[model samples]
Target: MMMITTGRMLRCVSLVSMVIFAVLVNECSSQHTVWDPVHASIKNDIAQGVELNAWCKSKNTDFGHHRIAYGDEFVWTFKINFWNTTLYWCKMWWTDVDGKYTEGSYAIYKAERDWDECQNECHYSVRRDGIYQNNYASDVSDLVYPWPK
Candidate 1:
């Protein structure tokens, strides 16, 4: 009768809806996840890591965790060959949700230094611009210092 037909129609609709829902769930489960973009860090090396001068904000690589290895002074040391290592950069600062950079107190306000110029100071420079490795002695290379603006 009418009641039997109504019940069968309802069952058919329920089965169809369940099949659609299951398919949707399976499709979503098989989809891949997306990654966010890399950002830079703001930190510096003064004496220790006073405020923040140099920083690196990047996506962590699958093979290695990202790190900004540097110091305010020369207190921090490099584990690898100093020339191939990250020894000169530190972190900088950003303000609010909008990402405005607020220069921090830790920064020496000094310019970015060439490898040679830094070598002349209390620190070690990986690539000596003017100095040559012949056997023993070397000459003082003209230094050109670069600062962050």
Candidate 2:
């Protein structure tokens, strides 16, 4: 049987430690800072052009839009910076018959490392009877409704 030497054993340990260190560094660097744009679609059927606005609220930041026209189908995208596990709320609104903005619908998401848990696409429609529907999409799930009242 061959005898093991102390220097060789030490070198083997050093190599294993270095490999572990490299793997940790790679994992830390691979944590991505995602600036993802959420796609939104608004279908208007009130017989008039209505202003649309979409936004999201997070712990430290609120991001979204001001005033956009909802003609036929209003489509827009808003960007959000996702980094940690945070509760985010997204809301959309349109101008009513009295020219006042009303909260049409909203969605709440608990975002984790992957934003796939949250909604990546939002679809809203205003019926001729002044009713609205809120729909959202995700990778793991399909269209969901009535989120947390």
- CA deviation > 4 Å runs, candidate 2: 1-48, 71-83, 95-109, 117-141, 146-149
Query: Worst 10-residue stretch by lDDT in candidate 1?
Result: 128-137
lDDT of 2 by residue, 42-149 (tens): 555544665656565666667666554555565655555444465556576666667765664444444452254335564555443443434323223333433222
Name the candidate that leads on lDDT: 2
TM-score of 2: 0.37
lDDT of each: 0.31, 0.54
Candidate 1 residue-wise lDDT, 94-146, digit = tens = 23234433432222112222222332122322121211111111444232232
After superposition of all CA atoms, the RMSD between model 2 and the true structure is 8.4
The best candidate in terms of TM-score: 2
